[model samples]
Target: MTVATHPLVARARLLADDLLAPHAERVDQAGVPVSHVEAVKRSGLLGVGAPAEYGGAAAPAAVARRTAEILAGACCSTWFVTTQHYTPVKLLAASGLPVRERLLRPLASGELLAGIAYAHVRAFPRVPVRAVPERGGWRFDGTVPWYTGWGLNDVMLLAGVTDAAEVVFAFAEAREQPGLRPSPPMRLAALTASRTVSLRLEGLWLPGKAVVLRTPQKEFAVVDRPRNTNASPAVFGVADAALALLDGVPEAEETARSLRTRLDETRERAYALWDHPVPHERIEERLALKTRSYDLMRAATTAAVVAGGGRSLDLDSRAQRLFREGMFLLVQGQTAEVRRAHLGHLGD
Candidate 1:
C-alpha cells in the first residue's frame, strides 16, 4: 500500500517497503539518500505532529513508533538521524503562533526538513552563529557535529548556549545562512544510509520568533529517558527485524520469548522512570535503569539475529544486518560495565 492511501501507521510500513527497502543498496553507496529523505517528507510523516492549523496530522506515539520501526529495519542510520532529533523539533513546535506559522507548515509539507546538530565536540557549545542581538536577532558562529540529515534539512533546531551558558533552542532557516556548510558524507557501521554528519555554521543569524527553547521538561530529562530518541526506535525496530529473520529458523520460539521478555522489562523500566510520581534518589540510579534497559534490548536482538544458523551472513542476505545492528547497542551511552558499577554503588 502507498503511504498516501493507507492509515498513518499503515503508511509508515508502506514507506519502509516502498521507499527504504528497495533502495537500500543505492542509499548505502550514494552517501546520502537525498531522494529517500524527500520521500519521507512527501509521505507527510514529518508533519505528523504539527497541528492542523500549521498543516500536520499531530499523530500519536503509535504512529511514530510504527514508522520508526519499519524505516529503521530497512536503514538503521537514516532512522537514527531522523528520530534522534525528534524531541528538539517538537520543542520548536511549542514555540507557538508565529514560530509554528513560519516553520511548522514547511516542515510538514516537505518544503523544509528539520535536523538535529548533536555530538558537537562532545560537550555542548555555547557560541552563537550570530549573537550580536542586533535587528532583534542573534548573530552566531561555530561548527556542530551529528547534525543528521544535513544537506536535506531546511530548518535547524539547535541547542545554542548563551553567554551565561544557558542552553536554548534556536530555530531558523538553514539554507540562507552563508556560513553553514551542510557537511560532507560519511560511512557508519550500521544505518549507513541515514546521511548524518557534522555541520560548520560560521557567522549565521537567528532572529524573529525563532528563539531558544526554555522548557524544563526537555532540559531536565536524562539522555536515555524513555530510551534515547534514537535508541528507542532502533531497539524496537531491530527487534522486529530480528524476529523477521526468525521466520524460517528452528529457534524462533526461543528467541522470541527472550526478546519479548527483554522488551517488556525495558518498557517497564522506561515507564517507571518517566511515569513514577517520585523522583529517583540519585540521578545515576535512573540512568542505570536506562542503561540496563539498553543492555537487555541488545542481548535479545543479538540472540535473535545469530540464532538463524549463521545463514543470514550470506553477502546479499538481510541477516548480515543482524550482527552489525548488534554493534550499535554497544556504543549508546553507558556500557554494561558502567551500569554494573552504578548498581554496585547503589547496593553499597
Candidate 2:
C-alpha cells in the first residue's frame, strides 16, 4: 500500500484531526494528559517500526516518518512523549539478548510505553553514566541529565559507558527506585508537557537479563553519527504546521506561499537523501540538508509569530506554541557534530 494509505498513517491522521489538534494548545499549557497517551496506545502507533511478529505493523520507514510528521504537527507535546517509545522498540527488536523476548512484545504491542535515558551516552569521553560489572549484572552510577516522559513511561532503556570503552544499554522501570531518583519535571520554553527530568543514577543495578545491546563506543558513534546528520521529519512537520497558521492572515499570504514553496523543495530533497541506501555515504550532504531544514523551520515559525502580532504572545496562541516548539527542536537529539555543523552553517 502507498505510504499515504497505510493504516498506521490513516490512524495518525485521525488522531491528529479528531483529538490532538483540537486540544494541542491546552495540552501545551497544561501538559500532556494520561487520556491523550491512552488514546495513542489504543491507536497502535507505538508499534509502527517494530517487528510485525511481535504484534507490530513493521511499516516501511517512509510510513513511520510520515506518521511522526502528522503527530508532531498536530500536537508536538504529545508527539514528544510518544516518540520516545520507538527507540526502545527498535533496540529490542534488533537485540538477541534475553530482554528482547521479555520486553519487545509488550512494547511493540503498545501494552507498555518505554522512554529512553541514553542521550547522555553521546557525550562519549565524558560519560554521564557509568556501568561497571558487578554481582552477575552491572551497576550504573552517575546522572542522566535529561529524561523525558518520566511519569508517563512504564519502562526506560537506560545506557551507560563502561571503562572498557563500550556502551551498555539496559532496561529498568522508569521510576524512583533504590538508586534511580528523578528531579521534578523541568519548565521549558516548549514541550514542557513532555514531563522531562534529570535522573540521578546512584548505584542502580540491573541483571544481565536486562541488558540489550553492548557495543564499543566507537562502533556506536559510527552508527549514530549518520542518523543524527539526517533531518528529522518532525522538523518539516512543525514547519508545515507553522506555515498553515498563516492561512487566515491575508496580509501574510504572499510570504506564506513563498515559504511553503521553499519548504516543499527542501523537504523533497531531505527525504530523498533519507531514502538513500547507504546511510553513511553522503555525510556532508546529510548535514547540509539537516541544517537547511532547521533554517526553514526557524523561518516558518518566526513568520507565524510575526503574522500573529502581539496576540501570538498569548499563552493559548498556537503560533506562539509552535514558535517555542521550533526553538526546542533546534537542539533536540543534537550531538557535537550536529552542533558544529549547524553553527558553521549559520556562520556561512
Candidate 3:
C-alpha cells in the first residue's frame, strides 16, 4: 500500500529512504546520524506517539508499523532508533493523568528528545530501580548501560526498582544531577546517530513529578501491545532491503519471489497478534519464523557483500553497512533457544 494512503507512514518512508540511501555511507563512516535526526524532527515524526491533545498525530500501532517498515528498507539502524521514541511516550501517556501533562506535551512536540534505558545487558531491567525516599520524591541511584540515542534524547523513560513494582518509567533529563553519571557516546554496529551511553546514577535525583509509576510490584503500563507491532515495520523494511539486493543478483527475479513469499509469511504471522498479545503457541512458532527471517537478512547481506567484493569492505560502501546492520537480526531474539523457552512455558 502507498504511504500516502496513510500520510504519516508515507512520510516516514520518504524521509527514511532519502537519508538512508544517500547517507548510509556517511552515517557508517562518521558514526551516528545527527542530520537525519534533524530531518525526523522536522517531519513531525518525533511526535508520533504523543497524544493528539499535545498536537501530535498520536497514530496507532499500524501506522507506526508501516513507518518503521519504510524506514527499515533504507536503514535498519535508523528504524530501530526511530521506534524507541514513540512507544515509550505512549507508555507515558498511559501513566494516569498526572504524567501526561508534565512530560507528554513537550515530548510530543519534538521540543524534547527522549529514550528508554531499561536494558542492563544482563537481560531486561524489570525493576523499579533503587528508589530511596527523599524530599518530595525518591533518589534514583543506579545505572542502565547501553542506553541508545542518549545524545539526542532530552528525556528518558528510565526503568528501575523503587522498593516495589516490577517495571516503571522514570522521566529524566540530561541534567547535571549528582547521581546521574553519563558517558560519552559509545560505538556500535549501527544506529550510531543516537547518543548511546552508559548512565551511572550515583545520586542522580528525581522529583515526584518525574516518577511516573509509584505503585510497588505492579507494571505501570502495557509493553506487550506496542512492542509487537513496533517490530513488524522494521522487519518488513529489512525484507524490502533484502529484495532490493536480490534484484541485482543473477536469477534475481527468482530469488526475489522466493524471498518475498517468506517475507509475506513473516508479515502475516507477526501481524496476527496485532489485536492481542502473541499466544504462547504462536510465540513459539514465531520464534522459528523470526529466526528464519533473521537468516534471510544475513543471506541478503551476503549477496550485497559478494556483489560488492573488496569495494564492499571499503570505508564508503553500502554493502558493508548492510552487512553490519543485517547482523542485528542474528541477535534479534528469535532463535531456537528462545523458541524452546516459549514452548516450555506453553502450559505454565
Candidate 4:
C-alpha cells in the first residue's frame, strides 16, 4: 500500500509534526512527557502489527516499516519508547498461549503499553540473567543493563537464560516490586528521554502462565542472526530528517539529494535481503548494504550539522540532535559478527 493510503502512516506523520517535533528538544532534556505518550496511545499506531481480530490495523510489514520511518525521522526518542510495544505484540501473536488472549486485545487497543528487557538474551554465554526453576514458576536473577520506558510501560517482556542454556521469557509488572528494582532513570548522551534504566532482578518470580517463550539457546540464536543483521529503517529515517535540514542551503541541498538517492537504493536492497524467507542466504551482502547505509547516514547528518554552522552546536538544535541520533543508530542492532563485517566494509 502507498504510504498515504496506509492506515497508520498519516496518523504517525500527524503525531510527528504536531507532538514529537515540537517537544523534541524539551523531551531531550526533560525526558518524554507522559502527555506525549498519551498522544501516541490515543493515535492507535501502537497496534500496527497487532492482529485485526483485536481491533488492530495489522498492516503489512512494508507499511509498518514506513510508519516507523516517519516516526523515527520526526522524533527518535518518541519512536524508541513506543516502538518497544511491537515486539511483545508479535511475540504474543506467535505464542498461541492463553496469555495472548488476555493481553493482546488491551495491548492492541492501546489500553496498556509494553516495554522489553529481552535483548540481554543475546548475551547467552555471558549469562547476564539467569532463570531458576521455582514453585509453579521461575525465578529470574541478574541485571538488565538497558531497560527503556521505565515509568511509562505497563508491562515488560523479560527473559533470562536457564541452567540448561534455554532462554525463558515471561511477562512481568513494569513497576518496581520486591524482586524487580529499577535504577533511577539514567542520564544518557542520547535518547535519555526514553527513560532508560538498569534493572536489577533479584529472584523475581513469574508463574507458569506468565512465561511466553522457552527454547534452546542455539535455536534462539538461529532465529536471531538474520533479524539482527538487517538494517534498521530508523537509520534511513534519521538521515532523511537530517537531509531535510539542509534543503535551504543550495550546495548542501544537491549533495543531500545525491546521498538520499543512494540511501533509498541501498535501503531497498537491504530490506529485500531482510525479508528473504531463507534467513542465512546473502548475509554478507546484507552486512555490506547495512554498512553502506551507515556511511550515507553519517554523511547526511554531518552535512546537516555543517550547513547549520554555529547554531548546530546548540543542544536543542535539530542538526545536533540528528547527528547524535546517527551515532546511536550505528550500534543500535550491532552484534559482534555484524560489527566485524561492517568494519571490514569500511576498510574496502
Runs of candidate 2 with Cα error greater than 4 angstroms are none
Best by TM-score: 2
Put the candidates in lDDT order, highest first. Answer: 2, 4, 3, 1
Ranking by TM-score: 2, 4, 3, 1
Tens digits of lDDT, candidate 1, 11-75: 67887887776665455556546677777777777776666666777776555666776777776
The clash count for each model shown is: 16, 0, 20, 0
Q: After superposition, how far is residue 196 of candidate 2 from its true place, in Å?
A: 0.4
TM-score of each: 0.76, 0.98, 0.84, 0.97
Candidate 2 structure lDDT: 0.93
The models' CA-based lDDT, in order, is 0.59, 0.93, 0.64, 0.88
- Flag regions of model 4 displaced more than 4 Å: none
lDDT of 3 by residue, 78-142 (tens): 65665667756776777774767877787787777677775441233443246676887667766
lDDT of 4 by residue, 1-348 (tens): 686787688898889988898878888888888898889998899998888999688887887888888888888998999999998998898987778888889899898999999888887799999999899899999999999899999999999999899999889989999899999988877888889999999989899899888989999898888877888889989988998998879878679879989998998898888778898788888888888889999999999999999999999899899898888888876789888988888898
Instruction: Look at candidate 4 and give me any clashing residue pairs.
Output: none
Predicted candidate 2 versus true structure: per-residue lDDT over 1-348, tens digit per residue:
899999999999999999999999999989999999999999999999899999999999999999999999999999999999998998999998889999999999999999999999888799999999999999999999999998899999999999999999999998899988999899998999999999998999999999999999999888887768999999989999999999978999999999899888988888898889887789888999899999999999999999989999898999899989999999999998899999999999
Candidate 1 vs candidate 3, lDDT winner: 3
